[model samples]
Target: MGSPSSLKLGVQICGVGYGWGEWRHPDVPADASISLNFYRQQAQLAEAGRLDFLFIADSLHIHEKSNPHYLNRFEPLTLLSALATVTEHIGLVATASVSYTEPFNLARQLASLDHLSGGRAGWNVVTSWLSGTADNFGKAEHPPHRVRYYMAREHLSVVKGLWDSWEDDAFVRDKPSGEFFLPSKLHRLDHNGEFFRVKGPLNIARSPQGQPVIFQGGTSVEGREFAAGHADVVFLNPESLTEAQWRYQDIKGRAACLGRNLQQVQVLANIRPVVGRTASEVEQRYQHICQFITLEDALVTLGRPFNDHDFSRYPLDEPFPDVGDLGREHLQGHSEHIKQVARDEKLTLRQTAWRFALPQREFTGTPEQLADRLEHWFQQGAADGFVINPWPGGLQHFVELVIPELQRRGLFRREYSGHTLRDHLQLSTPINRYAPRRELI
Candidate 1:
């Protein structure tokens, strides 16, 4: 496997830092999640850095145990729409779920965002992981892990079909003939599947990219297949270089097996890099950040992947309990990883929770050191690019210090080459399915 010549960077724009204790930091505002001004600042900062995109992660359900950032945050598409007017040449990717929402509405909304942003929209397709999320959606019970993927596959097909409702040259406004749009160019998606039935013709015209880019984060067996088959971009979180390289190969190989272009399928790893000017300063910053992590909060945060399984119930000092198949129904891939790590290391309950609460040390260093690691990962085929974690102060440090280092090395772009998200990712524009077939006369 070969790596892309240049690295693509996407910043996760969130109000507070990513950790549970980050809100209590002196530099971070407690209300930053709800503040529009804070979000706008983050977006503009990412754009000024010549980064590829701004990613907004979201979920529908929350309880007292939810992380501070998730407890209060902007609805993704709404927030992205607002940010679209303020920024140019940056892709706006929103996380939305397929399990609860109707295909027609989602297709129309994402397509509208593409139009509003002049074609910089991307949808990070997700199947809601939190079990309590079913309550808000009025479902009797949460769908099983396998069932969710099945539903997602059908939902995506319906949405894509709706996006093709109008051909590219369908609308020709002519005052002389009083013609608005050619009737032959309009098509309806009469879709019936195991999960959802959507009859369309999306009301709006096709967006600038034909269809907004499809982003998927799938780590499980079924998920990997779904992502490899359909997604234009895949987001991942691997704890080590070996794991990263393995995942990168697996995803690219899967796409190849499906007769998909490897280049069109981009894999991005999520990284939270904590940087400082000097080695001492870096250690000081790392320690200062570590102070904010309370043991109680870490336990709560750690429970999320297991469908909020209360780790509090287990003895803090005892070996991590074996709850057989406990999280099989929710966040299957993540929960299993946590269990495997706990077993391998023989960590206690508290140790396991704390391990996940803190950011990995591989990404924490001086700016030059951080740049070298990123360059190494890029050249070694561990990732095509990286999604920077949203930690306000750390984000500022990275853009100010590390971005220039990478740019100087010719490892990242100094300016955006095109207007659309597809352009940044180097993906081709899709042909309209309903366009008329040309004939030789």
Candidate 2:
């Protein structure tokens, strides 16, 4: 808040990249989806550009009609662990679900990553909204929206409690006195909640940043409230500057209402950049990517929010099917967005499918022009930063071209100011919950 110069940037290292047809692109490696080196290279590029974090989004289940990248990819935490060794400063953020994992184990795993990476770790907390995910986890039905948020709130509380199990100075390792750890410093989290009852201290000690940064990405009413109360960052996918501004104000206002400092919670919108040396080139590249998307693939992407309800059975020229209560319980926000788009544009089923196929162009111009748009968003208070998902062959261009333009404009940092992810993002190190109680006045 002190200056207008501060800006946070992150690149989503989406497996095989973001576009649905990216894997088939000539410039993209055919095996990029499973290649560790591909991710390693991407991480290095982001670091070279002085980006804050490399985000890896995940899901527990995949349909046969899923995108090539989703059909095959590394698990988030495991992959981030491997990435930690190769990279030094870039924050490694992985999408993990409270719905699918227990609090204690996840807390330990994230703490370990923070230690291994020297505190450059972030956890994108999700409720796991994909349809059929519950089936794989031995549950016949997915929890309702409100119930999922309830579990998430309780789940985060338990994890945070477990993280504070051991005080920062608990480990003595004093060989001369034959002392290893102070006994009184360890605290057990006997958390009893409606969803879970985790009783224990986390096995791992607190890491350098105290705890990994918490990120949440849901726009529903419950989601907004939960994020305001708990998350350090809120990820968004707003469709326009007006929407982004509205959402930005809403989130910060909610946080303030809950007695949280407005600066503590950052809002990062998803931005898919399509940079080019010329406007004509950008159009060509956009069209080229669009050509690779098959109607079948488009249908699969369009149907995702509706719980993979197959759109193939209906005639392509006809209006979208009524989808009566198809995704009412799951992906309600996204399904509603899609329905609104279809209704507003009066798009046919095929047109809606095609629209879904094309990547949303958050920025598409020369590097300088792209920089202008980003600056506009930042200065206008539409966003604190952006989580960029570059299309195939776009990463190198963005790093080499757009990044420098931004640096020239003094919109991004030329060098990392600190080691931890929190430092890079300008977020404060959280206070340890187990600290000694102060005497009352």
Candidate 3:
């Protein structure tokens, strides 16, 4: 919303990388996923690039066949908190699920992060999609897709209400008067809802930003509605520009219909760009990254969206097996998207497996070419910005190559102009709901 000429970018700081084969790349360390130093370095690198934020993705459940990076990775909030001290200005965004966490705990932890990071904190709200996650959380069954949304709405409502427990000037330490805080400035949430019943004030005071930014990344019908009604930012994973454009328009329209400010909401697409100086180098890098993924690994990876449906049992060359409603209960949108892709392309089971496993080539090209694609997306209103999910060594390439091109074209900022995440995004601080209209302390 600051300017149509520039873009906001965030780096996905996953150590082993987004692709299943990425850790096998020579530039990546096998244990980088768990290494604090590795994360520190990535955070510093992203900050140096003047990126908008650092996104740390998390999942509550993992099986033996899970992606190597997911199998061994730091928790999002813990990792981001560690990152906060080493880097300044770069927003720290952590993904946490509403289905498995208590509202008070989640609210307190995220508020703490906002305070620790000097207001550069964001929470990417997620409804846990894996059916197996229920086992970890001690639930008899995972909440249905619709039920998860209902719980998410209530959970988020309670969290926000708690976040507003104290006014900005609530704490006033006066020695002579022996006053620690203004009593009238402190308020209680006293929330009782369908999913959460939290009472009284939050333990922490209002953070520098007043409230930490809210991020929503669900793509289903319910997910989009949640984002439109509540999210400050929306994360998307569209397979093509056409899909991205449709989602972009749909989300903006939905928010508009709800009478929300269009500029207050931002849409970010997740792009894994395979970059190089030359076409030959780009192809080589792409192939090099692909070599590590075996057919078995692809099958296992494919099974994930289908609620761990065993794709191995079906013939590789045969048409994708019809497992109706297989993924509807879990990852409904994603599983459906995969099935649609398979149907549209008439791909074999093996083809569908590899298609999703390997990084999409829509963003594969030289620096200039990648810049062209990104600029197109921005100018055409397909996205407000992008969450750059790098392959092994890809972040460095993007930072060094594509970013420079964007800056030169006046499509990105060459330097930081502000400190807080809201400032970086040119968004105004939200007034506390509990604060009086014209009262000043």
lDDT (tens digit, per residue) of candidate 2 on 201-255:
8899999999899999887788888888899989988888998999999899999
The TM-score obtained by model 1 is 0.97
Off by over 4 Å in 1: 1-4, 436-441
lDDT of each: 0.89, 0.86, 0.89
Q: Using lDDT as the measure, which candidate wins? A: 3
Deviation (Å) of 384 in candidate 2: 0.5
Taking all chains together, each candidate's TM-score versus the true structure is: 0.97, 0.96, 0.97
lDDT of 3 by residue, 344-380 (tens): 9999999999898886889999999999999999888
Query: Quick one: how many clashes does candidate 1 have?
Result: 0
Q: Which structure is stronger by lDDT: 1 or 3?
A: 3
* lDDT rank order: 3, 1, 2
